[model samples]
Target: MRSDPALIGPLLERIAAWRAGHAGLFVLGVCGAQGSGKSTLVATLAERLTQAGVAVAALSLDDLYRTHAERQALAREVHPLLATRGVPGTHDVALGLATIAALERGEAAALPRFDKAADDRVPRGEWPHAPANAQVLLLEGWCLGAKPQDTAALAAPVNDLEAREDPDGVWRVHVNAALEADYQRLFARLDRLLLLAAPGWDVVAGWREQQEAELRQIGGARVMNPAGVARFIQHYERLTRHILSEMPTRADLTVRLGPNREVLELMPGA
Candidate 1:
C-alpha cells in the first residue's frame, strides 16, 4: 500500500496478464538506484499481489553476495577492489541462478540473506525457506536489469574511486566483464523488468544519506558515516550511470522519478 497506485496498478495488471498466459513463476525484476525505494516498492507489490490471491516470493540480489572470506580470496587473486561488495564480480551468480532454478522446479528453496553489518552472507542453513509453487517471484536490485557497458567505456575513470584506487582500470573492467557473463545468465531469467529511474546520479548521495540516518536510528549495524556514503557510492557510479543511460528504453516498464523520488512519468519499454 505504501507503493504508489499509479505504478502498482499497472504492474499488477501486467503480473496478472503474465500469470494467465504463462505457468509457474514469473520473475519480475525491479531495478532502482540506491535509496530510491525499490525495496519498499517491492514489499508493497508483494503484499498487494498476495492479497489479490497470487502466491508471491521476494528476493534481493544483495542477498547473493559472496561471503567475506570468499571476497578476501578474490581480493588477493583478482584485484584489491574485489574485497568490497556491491559490484557484479563480488556476487555469487551461480547461486542466484540455482535458487531460481529450484523455485521454478516447484521445490522449496533456501532464500539467501546478506548481513550488511557483517558484510557477508548469512549461512545457508540459517536462510529462510521459501515454499514451492510460487506464481510470481520478485527479483530486485540496484542493477538487476542492467546491460554490460562497452569495453571502451571502462577505460575512463568515472570517479575518484576509479581514478585513485583503481588507477590501472582493473576493477571496472573486471566488473564489466562480469556483467557480460554470469550476470547476464542471472538477468536473463527475468520475465519482466521495471526500472525506478532516478532523475540523475546527483540525487543518489542525498537519498543514500537518508537511508544511513534511518539505519542508525534503527541501530542497523555497519552503517557507514555520512562521508563514507560519498566514497562508497563511487563503487556503483559507473554501472549505475550506465544503467540510467541504457536500461530506461530496455526495461519492460520504466517509472521515471524526480530528485525527490516522486514519479515524473511512466512509459512502456521500447
Candidate 2:
C-alpha cells in the first residue's frame, strides 16, 4: 500500500529480470522483522507477476503454526517458550520443503491456513490450484532464513519473554542448529533472495506497537497490547538481531526500512 513507486519499481524490476532468466521453480525468501512490511512487498510482487501472466503462488510460514492445544502441550513438556511461537521451531519446515518440492514438480498442493485469533492452524482442507503454468513461489516470514548467534554469546541475558519461558534459549538453539545444517539446503533452492533490512529492536518495537494499535481499533479485543507485542518481539529478538547483522553479508539484495517502517533504501548487498 505504499504510494511511492521508488520502492516498488526497483523490486519489481529485479523480480522481472529473475523470472525472465530462470524457468525453474523460483523461491524468493522475503525476510524482515515483525511488522516490517515483508508480506506487503510479497503481495505486491505476486500481484504484479500474476498480471503479467507469470503464474505465482504466495506461501507464508505463519500458515504452519501448530494447533493451540499442541503448542500448550509443547510448552509444558518440550519448553514453555514453544508457546511463544514465531521463532524458527514454530514451523513445520519439512512440510514447507515438501510443499516447495511439489510446486517444483508442477503439482497442485493443499495448504493449511493458520488462524492467529485462534492461535492454531485450521484444517480447512483448502487447496490452492497450482495451474500447469504457475511459475514463481513467494515464501516469506520473520525467520525465513534466520541463523542463530554463537552459543558462548548465548549466555547473555535475554528479555523477559525469553526468561519467563525459554530461559535456556532452547528454541533458538535448536532452530539455529537445524538451520546451520539444512537451511542452506533450502536456500540453495531459491533462485534469488530478497531481504527487507529492518532496523534494530527499538525500531521494530515501534512498528509492532503501531500495528497492534491499529489492529485494536479495528478488531477490538483481537489485537495484542504493548506488553503482548513486547513478548512476541522477545521470541524473535535473537533471530531479528541476527538478520540485522548477518543479512547484509548473506542476501543478494537488501532493502532497508526506516524508523517509520518505510522503505529507506534498496541497494545491492554488502
For candidate 1, give the lDDT of residue 35: 86
- The Cα local distance difference test for each model comes to 0.88, 0.74
Show where candidate 2 strays beyond 4 Å.
Answer: 1-3, 181-184
lDDT of 2 by residue, 1-270 (tens): 354587777877887777786877878888877888878878888888788888788888788666788778877876767776676556666767787888888877665578787677766665455555458888888777766568775665567766666667676577667667666566667777778887788888788888889988888656787888777767777777778888777787888878876777877865
How far residue 66's Cα lies from its native spot in candidate 1, in Å, is 0.3
> Pairs clashing in candidate 1?
none
The TM-score values for the models, in the order shown, are: 0.96, 0.91
Q: What C-alpha lDDT, on a 0 to 100 scale, does residue 243 get in candidate 2?
A: 80
